[model samples]
Every structure is written in C-alpha cells, then in structure tokens.
Target chain A: MKKYIAKRVLNALFVVWLVATVVFFGLRAIPGGPVRTMLGAEATEEAVNRMRAELGLDQPLYVQYAEWMLDLITLDLGQSLTSGEQISVMMASAVPRTLSIALIGVVVGLGIALPTGIISATRKGQRSDYVATVAAFLGLSMPAFFIGILLALVFGVWWGVLPIVGYAPLQEDGIVEWFRRILLPGISVGVPYAAVVMRMTRSSLLEVLDAEYMKTAKAKGVGRTTRLYKHAMQNALIPVVTVAGIQIALVLVGSVTVELVFGIQGIGRLLVDAILDRNYPVTQSVILLVAAIMVFMNLTVDIIYTFLDPRIRYGDEAS
Target chain B: MTMLEIRNLRTEFETQRGTVTAVNGVDLHIDNGEIVGLVGESGSGKSVLAQSVMRLVEDPGEVTADELLFKGEPLLEKSEAEMTAIRGNEISMVFQDPMNSLNPTITVGEQIAETVRLHQDVGESVSLSAEMKRKIIGASKASESWRRAIEMLESVQIPHPESRATDYPHEFSGGMRQRAMIAIALSCEPDLLIADEPTTALDVTIQAQILEELHDILEVFDTSILLITHDLAVVAETCDRVNVMYAGEMVERATARDLFENPQHPYTQALLASTPQVETAVDELKPIPGTVPEPIDIPYACHFAPRCPEAKEECFEVDPAFRRVGSEGHEAACIRREPVDGEVIENE
Candidate 1:
C-alpha cells in the first residue's frame, strides 16, 4: 500500500511538472508580454525595454523558465507582475475563499443527493421517484448563474431571508453568519452538481439494488432498510465517490462563475483578473495549483477505491 | 413434520399488456431435513416459485396462495416484519449464480456474520432496521457473531478461516463461494432453506462438491431445502422427492428415483430423454422440441400440449389436472392418467 501510494505521488508530481511546463511556455507563447500590458503602447520603446528587463521578460524563454522553476522549487511564488504583491499570499486568501463555497456546495449537493437518490432507487417508478427525476432534470438543465439569480431574487430580494451579495470570511464572521452569507451562492453551484450526483447515485444504486446479492441478503432475512442501505448502498457509493471526485474540478470551475454571481473574492476571480491583466506570476501560479489539485483528487479517488473494494487492494497485493 | 407447504399458489406479473401467470396453481410441500427439488427448464417458473415462497418476488409480480405455510405457520398472513424474522432465522435461501449472488464488496465472513447477528445473537427486540448498524450492538456481541462467522467459513471447508474471514467474496473461487452461501443459509440452522439452482453456474466437479456440502448440511444442520434446479442429475444426487413444473404449473411429482425411472407425463419423459448420458454418443442427445412458452403465450390447455408428442385434440382444449399415477404419492398432470369415459389415445 505504501509503495503504491509512493508510486502515485511520483506520478502526480510528474503530471504537475508537465502542466507547469505547459503553462510556463504557453503563457509566454501568447502574442504579448506583461511589460507591454503594464506600460501600454503609449510608452516609448526604451521605456518598454527597461520595464521588460526589470521584469525578466526580456531574457530568453529557457532562462526565464529555469529561474521560475528554481523559484517554484524553493517554494517562492514571486510577486504579481502588476501589483508587486506576494503571489502566495494572494493565493492563500483566494484558495480558501473559493474552496469554502465549493465545500458548502459539496455538502449541499450530497445532502440533497443521498436521501433523494436512495429514495428514488428504492421506490423506483413511484411518485416520489418521478418527482425527484423531474426535479433532477430541472437542476441539471438550468445554469448555475440562473440558479444564483433565482436564489438571490427569492431569498435576497423577495423574502429577504438570507444575504446574497456579501462575502463572509469564517474566521471573522463566526460559523452561523458565514453559512448564512454563503448558503445562497453555495446552493446555486450545488443544485446542478446535486442533480449530477443524484442521478449517479440513483442509477448506480438502482443497479445494485437489483443485483442478485441484494436478493441473497433479502433471503437471509435482512430488512428492506438494511437491504437498501447496508447491502446495496456501499456498492452504489463506489461510482458516486468517483463522480464526486471528478465533480470537485467542476466545483472549482463552477466557483468561478458563482464567485462573480455572489460578489465573493476567490482564486477563480483572481485567475481571471490575472489573465486579463497579463500578470504572469499570478496566472502561472493559479494554473499550476489547479493542476496539482486535479492530480491530487485523482490520487485520492484511486486510494479510496482500495478501501471501498478489496479486489483493488488485496487482489494484487496478496498474489 | 412438514417444513414448508404451498397450496393453490399462483404468482403473476401484471404487465402493461396483460397479467402473465408465472406460477399457476401449484401445491407442494417439503418434509423436515429433506431436500425437495423443484425441477424445470428455464422460464418454467421454478425460480419464480422459489421467490414466491420467500415473498421476495419483485413487482409487477404478485403472489397469492390458499395456504402459504412454513413450519405449520401461515406465511401469507404474516406481516413483512414478521416474515423478515422468519427468513434466515426460520427459513433461509441459497440462490443460483454464485458468482453474482454474494456481494462483491463484502467480506464473506462479514456477510454470514451479519445474518447471524441480525437473527441469531441479537435479541428479538433488535428490530430489523437495526441490521444497518450492527456495530452499535455491544462489542462483545459483535465479536461473538464474528467468531460464529469464522466458524461458518470453516464449516464450509474454506481454508484459513481466520484469515479468509476478512477476505471479500471475490477472493473465493466459484465453488467455494457456493459453499459459503450454503454456510450462510444454514448459519441459523433454519427449518427450511430455499436453494434455487444453487449449483447451476458450477462445473461438474464443483457441482458434486456443492451437492456433497448440501448433504452434509442436511446431516449436520438437519435443514430442509427447497432445491430448485434444471438438472435431473443434481436432483438424483441431492433431492429426496421431486416436483416437476412446466410453464408455471406442476406437471409431475414423485420420489426422485421413481420420477426418473417411470416419468408418466410426456413432458417429464421428454426432459429425461433430453439429459445427455455418458452411455450414449453426443448426437443421441434429444433436445426438447420447443422452448418453454412465455407466460402470456401459455394456453388455457395443458402447458406442455403444444410440445408433447402424445398431445391430442382434447389436450389442446382442456388443462390436465394432477392425477394419481404409478405409485402412492406420485402425481402427473396428463389426461391419459385420468379415467375418462372414452379411452382417448390408447395406453402404449
């Protein structure tokens, strides 16, 4: 197990390195440099040259890449080209802000998906299942932004129950207000994700529920609840967990639009601004971080598989 | 004593087009510690009859019986909850398709132990719902059932019971998995065990081992089994009495030996001839003429009339009811066995 995980970690690092190399070269390959964006075309050639030289943009691509790689190895993200603010600090704040809402989205997604999926699977073809199916389609088809606006209108404007526009940092605002501030935005991103998770759960569970083993369990005198939850649910959860891991990336991508919708400052918005402003350091760092997360999530899913199924782990190991 | 009895039992599926009767009016019983085989080809409703007895038939399928009694108790009148207690504890089942019947993710021992805990170690008050969280019970009790689980594994002749107890079902071979299932069904030493084609998916050698295990279980646990299968050889090896069904109804029934020796019903005769014997060459194998008709297509006349070689005009018009045949307790649903006014289709 340790060896397997070690191998996975090495594979993950190689992927991150590959992504880092792509973004470093790819960002530079774009038509213009950050110096010009910072100085504007109005600036004289000499002024532009001076700015480029200062920013290390005037150097050969290999030289700049080497230096950037060195800096990255030393855990130094450098400063934003435009702001001269520490890139790491910017990320530290932005990542959490983004991850917090995404976490809430996951929580809400699972909260809605688990019960509804189980109910839909067990009472399949019944009224509740049909209702859930219809609701799931609506959730899937509707865009996050539209859902965000709908929520904002209902909870923020119509009933005036929850805040829609404000950003609440948990450390400052305490748990209740933090949740209150984030809930609407969280639901906006979550509803669509919930639909996906719910569908996966329902279909996966429906298949397992009908499995011959489930009948075996029933004949063994297992109750209806036990058959569905204990006998069936664990097997069904394997696919749901896999989909959920992949969906985490979706949540990251989702938080970008949702952050804008609710006016929260997160990594996604920071990445967008960095790209628009041609801030090389910030853009490169954000892109690498996202890639690293992707690699990490994939590894986590594989590791989870070992625990969920003995076949994956012991099947090879024992042999 | 009678272990299981089903009289006038009918199982039907209410399909969109119409109601498809799967198990037509069927009367059968199993005696204590005996393996009573329900034999038929695929789609003959033998498996459906097993599911009906367990009340595990999925919907649009419905089961009704004049008397669905188990161990002298009327199972039809019992609530689902009451039935749940009786299942696995009083009457468990071993299904076909051993490869898929055991949960792939669960440890074989844990699966067996769960049944033992749910119905054996835990008191009656531990409602069926409590099965979801057996760990919440006292740790000592939990470990106690775990011990029983390992014992069950050992009893099934699985090697390294202590270690294999932790291994999942997929780790066990097909034959071993079937044995594990037998171990589970007999865990509570239930009065009746419904083994539906338990050895169907196994090879000949493995099939023999499984039958050996079933016989061992009968001696050790004294558990009566409703062994449903398509193999005449398996019934000859394991069953005491045999009930032959054809397209949802009991066509013939008798002692396993007598049924094979003198099959009164033409369908039974056809089935016996269809069996590939080592005594004959390959081409001598007599395949049944037509497939078992789908439930909806089954005629009001004798289910086998369309396929029976001796089928007469009246055989296609009127259903033949079960009538006495060669020996005491032997019955066959064939008009020839009936003492009608006219000697239609003279005795051969």
Candidate 2:
C-alpha cells in the first residue's frame, strides 16, 4: 500500500509537470503578443515592451518557464495580469461555482442514470430498454449549450420558473436557494454526461449479466434483486468508474459552454475571458487547475481499481 | 420410492441462429442414498439435464419433461415461487467451476449459512437463548444449524474450518474452493445433492481426494447424489449406477460394473475405447470420429448416427428406442447391440 501510494504520487507529479510545461509553451505560441493584447494599439511599442518587462514576459522562454516552475513549486501562482490579485485567490472565488454546478450535475446525472441503466440492462430487449436507449441517443447528440438555451427559453423566459442566466454564491445565502438558482443550467450541462454514463452502465451491466459467475449466482437460488445489486452491479462498476472519470474531464470542458450560456462567473468563464484579454497569469492558472483536477480524477480512478477488483494493484504487489 | 425421477426430459433453446434441442428426451432416476453418475462429453447435455431437473433453465429455453418428481411431488408443474422453495432447500447443487459457483464478495461460511437460514425457520428467542449462538444467524436457523455448518466444512476436510471459512472465494485454492462448494451444498443437508462436474476444475489428485471425501460423507448422510461428469474414470471410481449420454439422449444406463464390463451402445463402446490408459503408450487411441451434432438443425433420427462407426441405414431413418440389452435394468439405444461377432476388449 505504501509503495502503491508512492508510485501514484510520483506519477501525479510527472503529469502536473507535463501539463504545466505544455500550457506555458502553447499559450506563448498563440499569434499575438500578450503585452500588446493587454494594453491595446493605443499604447506605444516602447510602453508595450516596458509592460512586457514588468510582466516578466520579456525574459527568454526557458528562463520564464524555470521561474514559473519555481513559483509553482513554492505554491506561489503569482497575481492575475489584469486583476493584480493572486491567481489562487481568483480560483478560490470561481472554483466553488464551477464545482457546485458540476457536483449537482453529477449527482443528478447518476440519480437518473444508475437506476435507468440497471433496469434497462436487466429488462434487456424490453420496451423500457428501447426507450432508455433512444433517450440516451438524443441526449448524446444534443449539445449542452443548445440544450441550456432551449431550457432557458422555455422555462426562464416563457414560464419564469427559474433564474435562467447568472449565478449566486452559496455562502451569501443558504445551499437550497443557491441550488434552486443553479438547477436549470446544471441539469442542461448534466444531460449529456448522464446519457453517456447511462449507456456505459447499461452496456457494462449487460455484459456482466452474461458472465459465467452470474449464472452461478442465479443457480444458487438467490433472489433476482439481490443477485443483481450485489452480484452483477458490483462487477459492472469497473467500467462505470472509468466512464465517470472521463465524464469529469468532459464536465470541465462542458463548463466553459455552460458558463457562457448561463452567465455564471465560474473558472471556465474566467479562463475564456482571460484568453480573450490575453491575461497570461489567470489563463495559465486556470489551465493548471484543470490539469491538476484531471490528474487527480485519473488517480482516483486508479486507486479505486484495487478496491473494485482484488486482482488489481499499483505495482502488481502481492496483496 | 425414488428421491428424484425425470422421464423424457427435453430442453430446447430458441436462439437467433435457430431453435435448438439441447437436452433431447433424456430420462434419469436416483433412488434414496444412491449416487447416480450422469457421464457424457461436453455437448451431450449432462449439465443441461441436471439443470432441467432443478427447473433452473430460463426463458427462450423450454424444459419439457413428461414426468419429473421429487419425493412423489411433481416438479414440472411447480410455480416459480414453489420451485424457489424447492431449490437450495430440498435439493442443493454444487457446480463444476468453484471459482464461478460461489459469490466472490461473500465469505465462504456466510454463503453456506445463508442457504441454511433461507430454508429453516428459527425464532430469535430460541436462537438467542442457545449458548452456542455467539455468531450471527442469517435469516432464521436453529443454533444447532450454525454448528452443523461448521461441521459440514470440517466434514469436507477443509483445514481450519473457522478461519478458512471466513475467507472469500477468491482467497481459496482450487481444491479448497471445491471443498467450500461441497460445504455449502451439504449445509442444508438436502435430500438430493447435485454435483455438476464438481471435480472437473480440480487437479487429478485433488479430484480423487474430493471424490473420496464425497463418498465418506455419503456413507454418513441419507442424501442421494446426481454426479455429472465427462470423465469415465470418475464414474468408475465414485458412481454406483452410470448413465451414458450422447447428443442429449441417454444411450446407455446400467450398474457401473455392468456398463463398463459389458458395454452395449456403439457410442459407449467408442467412449470406453477412447479412455486413456496411463500404462500403455498406445500409438492409435480410438477416438469417436465425428463431433456431436449441432443443437440447431439436429438430425431427425438418432443424433449420434454421424459419429457412430457401426451406424447402419436404419440408424438415420429411425430414432432408436432404449431396448433392454442384457440382465435386469440394463439398457442401450443402439441397433447393432444384439448378435455381436467380436470378443469385447476388457480393461484388465
């Protein structure tokens, strides 16, 4: 267990290094100077150069990269280029909104998907299964942004039932009101995620049902429900875990679109604004945050494998 | 009175390919305390026949039996609820692969005790009052039943019945897993214990030890066994009466001694001839020529005709009925059993 954890930590550090380096260089290569974009055409070339020096962008690429890495190692993400505030503090403000939206979305997605998936797989070739498959297909095809707008048009504009656009921090008010405000946008973002998870769960479960061990369980004369939940579902969860991990990354991507549609002040929206304004620090920090989460999510899935399957371990150690 | 009697049992499956007859008109009987070995090759439907008796065969697969009774109770007509009650209570089954048979997540002892508690009804007051009831009781079973479960494990010669029983299925070796399966099967002490190739997945030495342990258990218990296997040596060692199956039908049924000493059916003869002798490096071991017919689009008459070396024109035209061959209760479903010319090769 110690060795497994050690290996995972080292692997996570390697991933963070790769992600940070790629983001730094890729943003640098984009077809505009950061200082000129931030200052605009009104500023003189000398003033732009002066601004670039002040921002430390005038340094050689390798030196800038080394400084950034050093800052990152010391947990000093530096101040936002435009805001003149710590990037970490900016993240602290935006991350909760993004996470809340994603969390509610995930819960709703699983709530809709798990039972539906299991039932669809169990009933298999039945009317309900066919209906679920069709719904999943529709959900998969429909874009979250389009879905959000459509929902906002119907419910927010027409019925006036929900706050269609914008976000409220949960700290100012209670969780319930915050949840009520976020529901429509969260659901819109979650629909595709839920559909993907549902399809994966159903397919994986169907395969597990046909496995030899399931037959053995049934032959034991155990109740159908017990056999399904305990025997079949447990085995089926490996792929479900995988699909969920992938969905986390997809959800982060979807958040950008969701933030734009709903007018939510989230990290995804901030990242987009930072890119548009050439705010290097904010954009780099956001990218690093996302990369960190993705790395963490992947690590979580890997760690879960040992628990899910007895045969799996970090370094093929005798457990 | 017979503990279990299955007459003209047939299990047909409807697949996308076509409707297939898996267990075609097979008859089997096991009287009280008799271990009946149902031996055949893989596709011969030995497992299917055993499953059919339990009504474990699911939908799109129909199990039809002219008469199937357990202790004079009609099995075929029983409701799903009724069948559920019968299964794991009056009749318990141990499967071929122990790895697949036991639930992976559940502990070995809990698996056995669950079966015990499912069938029996023991009051909480009665259970609690008993001094021996230190451990948990799944559902409701008498305190004695828990001890009996431990005893069952011990009887199966499982090392460290207490500690080992707590371990899950994946923790066990092949032999130990088979032992745990036997423990679970025998936990309820059902009247009929169906061991469906129980030793097939075990090593040869383990298989022999398991068979020996099974025989010892049978000596003590009043239970009848339906031992299903493709291994002829297993039958010769453990079984009292042997039924030879070919392509879902029973080709021969007789005492183990009678069947082996004086084989009747051509398929049975071929099967015996094919049995590998360890002593001799026989250059050409006789193997049955053709494979068993496909379950779908099966032959109209005798299913084994294509594979039978001595198959005549009549074999293809008519389904040969089981005719009494020699001595009492000995039967075979072959055309050329009578008026044989050659001396039978006896295994010395």
Candidate 3:
C-alpha cells in the first residue's frame, strides 16, 4: 500500500508539472502580452521595452521558463504584472473562498443525491421515484449561474433572507456568517452537480440491486434498511464515487460563473480577471492550481476505491 | 415434528409482459432433522418457492398460500417485523454462486457475526440446557459474537478460522467461500437452512467436498435442510426425501431410495435417463427432449406432456393430480398410476 501511494504521489507531481508547463506556454501564446495590457495600447516602444525588461520578459523563453520552474519549486509564485501585488498573496485570499464554495457545494450535492437516488431506485415505479426523477431533470436543465440569479432574486432581493452579493471570510466574520454568505452560491453550483450524482446513484444502485449477491442478502433475511444501506449501497458507491470525483472538478469550474453572479472574489474570479488583464503569472498559477486540485481529487478517489473493494489492491502482484 | 408446511402456495409476478405465475399451486413439507431435496430445471420456480417461504420476494411478485406454516404457526399472517425476527434466527438460507453470495466488501466473519448480532437478545426466555444458555449469553456480547463467528467458521471446516474470518470473500477459494456461506447460514443455529443450489458454481470435486461438509454440519447442528438443486446425483447422495419439480409444480415426491428405484412420472423417468450415470455405459446420451414451458404460457392440462414419452391423449387434455403409487410415502403426478414396462405405451 505504501508503494502504491508513493507511485500515485509521483504521478500527481508529474501531472502538476505538466499543467504548469502547459499554462506557462499557453498564456504567452496569446496576442497581447502582460506588458501591453499593463501599459495600455498607446504606450511607446521604449516604455514597453523598459517595462518588459524590468519584468524580465526580454529574457529567452527557456531562461524565463527555467526561472519560473525554480521559483515554483521554492513555492515563490511571482507578483502580478498589472497590479504589482504578490500573486501568492492574492491567491491566499481567493483560494479559501473558492475552496469553501466547492467543498460545501459537493457536500450539499451528495447530501441531496444519495438519499434521493436510493429512494428513486428502491421504490422504482412509485410516486417518489417520479418526483425525484422530475426534480433531477429540472436541476440538470438549469445552468449554475441562472440558478444563482434565481436564488438571489428570491432569497436575497425579494424575501430579504440573505445578503445578495459579496463574500465573507470565515476567519474574520466567524463560521456562521461565512456559512450564510456561502450557502446560496453553494446550492446554485450544487444543484446541477447533485442532479448528475443523483442520476448516477440511481442507475448504479439499480444495477447493484439486481445483482445476485443482493438477492443472496435478501434471502439471508437481512432487514430492508440493512440490505439497502449496508449491502446494496456499498456496492453501488463504486460508480457514484467515480462520478462524484469528476463532478468536483465540474463544481470548481462552475463556481467561476456562480462566483460572478454572487460577487464572491475567489480563485475562479481571479482567473477571469487575470485573463482579461493578461496577468500571466496569476492566470497560469490559478489554472495550474485548479488542474492540480482535479488531479488530486481523482487520485484520492482511486485510493478510496482500494479501501471500498478488497479485490482492488494496488501495486500488488498484478498491475 | 414438521418444521415447515406449505399448502397450495402460488407465486405470481406482474411484469410488463403480463402476470406470470412462477410457482403454481404446490404443497411441500419438511420434517425436523430431515434433509429434503427440491430438484428442478432452471425457470421451474424452485428458487421462487424458497423465497416465498421467507417472504423475501420483492414488490410486484405476490405470494399467496392456503397455509404457510413454520412450527405449526401461520407464516402468512405474520407481520414483516415478526418475519424478520424469525428470519436468520429461526430459519436461514445459503445461496448459490459462492463468488457473489457473500458480500465482497466485508470480512466473511463479520458477515456471519452480523446475523448473530441482529437476532441476539439477552432477556428473552426460552427452555435451554445450562451450557446452551451460557453460550447464548456469551454470544449476546458484542466482542463474543466475533469469537462465536470464528467458531462457526471452524465448525464448517474452514482452516485457520481466526485469520480466515478477517479475509474477504474474494480471498477465499470457491469451496471455502461456500463453506463460509454455510457457516453464516448456520451461525444462529436456525431450525431450518434453505440451501439454494449451493454447489452449482463449484467444481465437481469441490461440489462433493461441500456436500460432504454440509451433511456432516447438518448432523452436528441438528438443523433440517432444504437443499435445492438440479443435479439428480447430488439429490440422491445428500437427501433423504426428494421432490421432483417440473414447470412450477411438484411432479414426483418420494424417499430418495424409492424415487431412484421406481421413478413413476414420465418427466422424472426422462430426467433420470438423461443424467449420465458413472457406472452405466450407453451408446448415446439421452437428453430431455424439450425445454420447460414459459411461465406465462404454461399449458393448462399438463406442463410435461410436450416432453413426456409416455404422454397419452388424456395427458394433453387433463391435468393429473398427485397420487400415491405402489409404495407408502411415494407419490407422482401421472394419469397411469402403475409403473411402466420398458416398452413405450402408445397414445390412443
């Protein structure tokens, strides 16, 4: 198991390196340089050259790439060219807000999905199944930003239950206030994700419930609760876990739109602003961070699979 | 001394196609300490009948019986909660496909111990010997259930029960997993154990070993067994009484010895002839001529008439009731009650 985890960690490092390299090169490929965006279109060639030289853009791509790679190794993400602020410092503030929204969105998604899926599957043709199915379809059809707007209109503007815009830092405002602020955006992002998970869960559980082992469990006189939760659900979770892992990345990406609608300054919003202003380091770092998160989540899911199924031992005799 | 009794039991399923009667009107009984075999082809409703006894058949499948009794108490009248108390505690089941029968995620031992824990009660009063009472008390404790689980595993002939108990089903060989299933089924010392094709997924050698272990365990545990199988030889070797089922109905029933010696029903005779005997050499193997009738479109008169060699004109027009034949405790469903000669009797 140690060997397996070591190999996975190495693989994750390689993936993060690959993403960093791609983002570094890809950002430079764009027509407008960060110098042009910072200095404005009317800037003279000498001023552009001086600004470029100061930012070390005059150096060869290889030297710049090597220096950036070295800085990355030492956890030194350089300052933003546009704002002259530390990219790391900007990320420090934005990362937590984005992470909270994604995490809470996922928790909310699973919370709604698992039970609804199980109920829809077990009571297949019943009214509850139909209701869940219709609700899932509606959730899937609506976009995350649209849901956020709708929620803001109802809960924020009309009902006056929640603040319509802006984010609160948990450490500054306490957890309760932070949670109240995060809840709307989280649900908006979560609804679509919950629909995906719910559908996956229903289908996966239906297949598992039809398996011969499930019948064996039923024959053993296991109670309905034990049979569904203990026997059927555990087996059903393999596919659901895979889908949920992938959905985490989706939620992170979708949080960008949700963050815009809710006016939360998170990593997603920072990436958007960085792209517009052509802040190369911030854009590349934020994109690389999101990619890293996706890779890590997938790796975690694979590790969880080993724990869920004994038959799936990794780095054993067989590959 | 009867452990279970079923009278005119029928199991029907409502499907998109139509209402399919899986198990037609049937009467079956198992006595205390008896090994009864229910033999049938696939889709003959043997498994459905077993599920009906435990009320394990799911929605859209309806089970109705004139009387479904366990220990002379009507099971049909019992609520699901009452049935849950009886299940695994008073009556347990071992299923086919050892590879899948046991839950793959859990250790084999915990699966066995769970059955014990689910039904364990400390204050429930029952007449028991002092040793049995002490064992029951020990089993009621959470930690002691694991110990009892390992003991049950050992009783089923699993080697190194302590370590093996912690291993998942995939870690065990097919035979060992089947043994583990038997161990779980018998952990609570149920009065009846329903083993549905317990050896079907095993190798021939492993099949014999599992049957031997099951026989020995049954003797020691003093539990009645309802062994469901399609193998005639398995029934002959392991069962005292045998019921031959055809198309959701019992066509013949007798002591294993009598059924083997004087098989009366044409379907039973064909089944014996089709089975390859170890000592008998024949020019060509005789296969049963036709498949079982579809459940929804089962023949009104006789289900086996299409395949029976001795089927007469009446066999296609009338359904024969089960009748006592030459020997006591021997019964068969055939218009001709007498035993047939080697020559076939032409239909007129």
TM-score of chain A of 1: 0.95
Q: CA lDDT, every prediction? A: 0.85, 0.81, 0.86
Model 3: residues with Cα > 4 Å off, grouped in runs:
A38-47, A315-319, B120-142, B336-348
Question: Fnat per model, in the order given?
Answer: 0.80, 0.24, 0.50
Q: Which stretches of candidate 1 lie over 4 Å from their true place?
A: A41-43, A314-319, B121-142, B279-283, B337-348
- Tens digits of per-residue lDDT, candidate 2, A34-120, equal 677778889988998888888888889999889988999999999888768888888898999899888877888888889889989
lDDT of 3 by residue, A1-319 (tens): 7888889889999999998998899888989988888888899999999999999999999999999999999999999988789988999999999989988899999999999999999999899999999999999999989999999999999999998788899889999889999999999889999999999999999999888778766655666776777777778999899999998977997899999999999998999999998888889889889988999999999988986677898875453
Off by over 4 Å in 2: A41-43, A310-319, B122-149, B278-283, B338-348
> What DockQ values do the models have?
0.66, 0.25, 0.42
lDDT score, candidate 3, position B306: 84
How would you encode candidate 3's per-residue C-alpha lDDT over B12-58 as one tens digit per residue? Answer: 99988888889988889999999999999998999999999988888
**Given candidate 3, what's the lDDT at residue A54?**
95
Query: Higher lDDT: candidate 2 or 3?
Result: 3
- lDDT, model 2, position B244: 93
Model 1 lDDT per residue over B254-288, tens place: 99988988889999999989997665556777888
DockQ of 1: 0.66
lDDT of 3 at B203: 96
- Better by lDDT, candidate 2 or 1: 1
